[model samples]
Target: MSAPWLADAVVLAHLAFILFVMFGGLLVLRWPRLAWLHLPAAAWGVAVEWTGWICPLTPLENALRERAGQQAYGGDFVQHYIMPLIYPDGLTRHTQLVLGALVLLLNVTVYAALWRRRGGRRG
Candidate 1:
C-alpha cells in the first residue's frame, strides 16, 4: 500500500484504539475474557495521559505521514486530532489530567457494576 494509505490506516486504528480504551469496559461486561486485553490497554491509555507520554502510535503515524510527503504534526494524536473537536482552545496539561481522571472514573464505574452483577465475589 502507499504511504498515504498506511498513514490513514494508522490514524483510523489509533482512533479505534482510543474508543476502545475509553469504553472497552462495556465490552468486558459482555465478554469477560476481553478484560485481559482491555485492562492493559486502558491502563496504557491512562498512563499516556497522566504521565504526558506520547503513545508510540503517534510517532508511527507521524513517520508514515512524513514518508507520504505530508506535513507531520507535533504533539500527541489527541492534541492533533481530537482536541480541536472537543476543545477549540486546545489541549492543556490540566485538560489531560482531567481526561485521565474521567477515563479512570468511567472504567471504574463499569467494572463496579460488573462486580455487583457477579455478586461481589472474586474469582
Candidate 2:
C-alpha cells in the first residue's frame, strides 16, 4: 500500500485500539475469557497516558505520514485525534493521569461486577 494509504490505515487501527482499550470491558461481560486480552490492553493504555510514553504505533504512523509528505502529529494518538473531539481544550498531564485512572477504575468496576456475576469463578 502507498504510504498515505498505510498511514490512514494506521490511524484507523489506532483509533479502533483506543476504543477497544476504553470500552472492551463490555466485551468481557459477554465472554469472560476476553479479560485476558482486555486487561492487558487496558494496562497498556493507562501506562501510555500516565507515563506520557509514545506507543510504538505513533512513530510508525508518523514515519508513514512523513514518507507520504504529511505532517506528523506530536502527541499520542488520543491527544492528537480523539481529544479534540471530546476535550476541545486539549490533553494535559493532569488530564492524562485522569485518563489513566479512569481506565483502571472503569475496568476494576466492570471486572468486579463480572466476578460477582460469575460467583468469583474465572471464566
Candidate 3:
C-alpha cells in the first residue's frame, strides 16, 4: 500500500485503539475474557495521558507521513487530530490529567460492575 494510505490506516487504527481504551470495559461487560486484553490497554492509555507520553503509534504515523513526502505535523496524535475535534482550545497538562482521571473513573466503574456480576469470585 502507498505510504499515504498506510498513514491513513494508522490514523484509523489509532483512533480505534483510543476508543477501545476509553470504552472497552463496556465490551468486557459482555465478554468477560476481554478484560485480560482491555486492562493493560486501558492502563497504557491512561498512563500516556497522565505522563504526557506520546503513543508509539503517533511516531509511526508521522514517519509514514514523512515517507509519503507529506508535511508532517508537530505534536502527538491526540493533540493534532483529536484535540481539535473535542477541545478546540488545545491540550494542556491539566487537560491531560483530567482525561486520564476520566478514563480511570470510567474503567473502574465498569470493572466494578463486572466484578459484582461475577459474584466477586476469586479465581
**How would you encode candidate 3's per-residue C-alpha lDDT over 3-119 as one tens digit per residue?**
999999999999999999999999999999999999999999999999999999988998999999998888899999999999999999999999999999999999999999999
Q: Write the per-residue lDDT of candidate 1 for residues 1-123, one digit (tens) a residue.
A: 998899999999999999999999999999988999999999999999999999999999899989989999999999999999999999999999999999999999999998899889776
lDDT of each: 0.95, 0.91, 0.95
* Residue-level lDDT tens digits of model 2 in 75-120: 8888889789989999999999999999889888999999899889
lDDT of 2 at 96: 93
- Candidate 3 has an lDDT of 0.95
* Steric overlap count per candidate: 0, 0, 0
Between 2 and 3, whose lDDT is larger?
Answer: 3
Model 1 lDDT-worst window of ten: 114-123
Task: Arrange candidates, best TM-score first.
Answer: 1, 3, 2
